[model samples]
Target: MANMDISLKEMMAIDGAIGAAVVDYNSGMSLGVLGGSKDLDLQIAGAGNTEVVKAKLRTMDSLGLKDAIEDILITLSGQYHIIRPITGRGGKGLFLYLALDRGRANLAMARHHLRAIEDKLEI
Candidate 1:
């Protein structure tokens, strides 16, 4: 099985990928990270995204929706930020966050590939 570092590397190999990290949402900390440029600080982003996950989960709970999140997509003029929670065995409270250059990424395929990677990941 792939480990956290291997999973992060695989994510960076995706088309248009700028950065990726495996974060523990409970603590807003990154367990592994890859490909952050000067403009992107993955540690800060991980903390921010943790709040996003918590907020969405809180909203779902308040609304009494018994659904699990697949992914949260944030589209910008130049980038697509994807936050995917790790739901595989032993992956509780963790998530995979990927940043893609909008012009180079295929959103649907990226999501599909991410799911595949997540499945093989062993925490």
Candidate 2:
């Protein structure tokens, strides 16, 4: 299994990746992070994304949706932000947040890679 640091590093290797982080939504804290541009702060992104995850989950609950979220994807003109919650055998309240360049990223492949990473990640 990959450790936190190694997992973040692997995330950065994804094509067009701008930044990545392993965050604890319950506490709004980042466990590990890698890469960022002058205008992008990973810490801020991590915390902000926590709210996004919570909001969606809350909405689902209110709607009585029975489906579980695999991930949340936000597409911008130039970037794509992906939020994937860790559902390891016993993992709770953790997620992987990734930002990539839309022009260079393959959303399908990136999602697949993130799933692989999540499956092997050690909390």
lDDT per residue for candidate 1 within 1-123, as digits (tens), equals 899889999999999999999999999999989998998899999999999999999999999999999999999999999999988899999999999999999999999999999999999
The list of candidate 2 runs beyond 4 A from truth reads none
lDDT agreement with native, every candidate? 0.95, 0.93
Sliding window of 10 residues with minimal summed lDDT for model 2: 85-94
Tens-digit lDDT track of model 2 for 1-123: 988899999999999999999999988999899998887799999999999999999999999999988999999999999999999964589999999999999999999999999999998
Alpha-carbon RMSD to native, per candidate: 0.6, 0.9
Off by over 4 Å in 1: none
User: Which residue pairs show backbone clashes in model 1?
Assistant: none
